[model samples]
Target: MKQETFGRFEVGSCSRSTELQEERELIQNPNLNPGSSSLSSVVNECKKRRPINFCQEEEEERSLKKRRIVQDTTIPEWLVNVMMREEINGYDPKLILAKKLYKSDIDKVQSRLSLPSNQVVTSDFLSEEESRVIYEQSVLKNRTEGLSVVLVDPLLKKHVVDLRKWKMGGNWNYVFVDGWNQVVSTNTFKVGNVYHVWSFRSGGGKLCFALVPPRNSSDSGHGGSSSGLSSR
Candidate 1:
């Protein structure tokens, strides 16, 4: 029904209807409401502004932690010279060196280890490249080839052993044990294990060395794990 006193659009104008709908929408949407503040809007804004990923940050932190592991396995050059000089100058170096077993240290040399009468030499006998460094020392280098030198035990002066430079193969730079099998048998060395060698006597025709067994796996932190190895 039309009001006789009003114009054609006076009943319900489009502008009036649109203004009412706008008020309803503002009331229904909390984010658009001018009368209240929304925490969700603040959170969305923060999320949009920040492009950072917490998971990536965590991973990088973990990687940095892992990289902190001390990597000082190989002995320094100066220390090698000190050990050699201690032997040559009659000071008799007194230090314990640890070495992890490699395939070359045990597997490839199983035959040499088992031979009761045959002598074998290895740079592996000394700690931290000591065997190689000793060979380069003037005392042993200047001596005639195949000259046997007694290595007296540091802990036990009476415990005397003999060693020499054996030039069979592999660049002719190796510490040859005149009685290697005997030493291995005496120490009960097993493959896939780390061993310790100590030096004491070098001058006076004696060079002393001692063998020590690994306390546990953790102590073999020097690396070159000897696991999954066979004597064959």
Candidate 2:
């Protein structure tokens, strides 16, 4: 009888089907001796013992570090000053968005601040709990209400708002509602005015935003020249 060897796997005058069955058994049965099993089967068993890939985890950490670097560089000096204020003193504030206000933003009927998906600076700024709440309420249950977030205006006044995703013209937009009217009214925000939105965690780890007005706006009471996100 002729024997063919494949890295310790020997087939001696056996049918192809038999060979295949034996190979499958050797791979599936963990108790099988490595001396009798094919090299490939032994390797597969070793892989099963340690499923985690440390290389992949290291790569993900590197990616997150890069994102943090980008966020730090993008935040402007004026915004940093706002974050450092006694009333604010935010935790690692990152500029997450900037948009020119539209009529719909301040419209009493809408009563929401629409942040288009494309205009956002970073989508991963939400904490795990915040993301889970938004996903369960907005995506799973299809509820109009979502995660509650604290929004700090340029004046450093905090307003609690509901954050949810809304589909419009086949694209999804993140919107602040159910308290946005207060922010608009309190800030005296006007249409066509540009505003920068910054995100940071509160001391208690709550999601918060700083809605910065145009640098020249008297509404903010921060005496600086008119500045938009043109340079950014």
Which is the leading candidate under lDDT?
Answer: 2
In Å, residue 125's CA in model 2 sits off its true spot by: 0.4
Q: Which ten residues in a row have the lowest lDDT in candidate 1?
A: 223-232
lDDT of 1: 0.39
In Å, residue 1's CA in model 2 sits off its true spot by 74
For TM-score, the strongest prediction is 2
Task: Report model 1's TM-score to 2 decimal places.
Answer: 0.32
Off by over 4 Å in 2: 1-73, 85-88, 142-144, 217-232
Candidate 1 displacement at residue 54 in angstroms: 20
- Per-model TM-score, in order, reads 0.32, 0.59
Expressed as tens digits, the lDDT of each residue in 100-196 for candidate 1 is 4444444335322211112222223344444444455424565444324433221112222334434444334334344543444333345565554
Predictions: Cα RMSD each: 20.8, 14.8
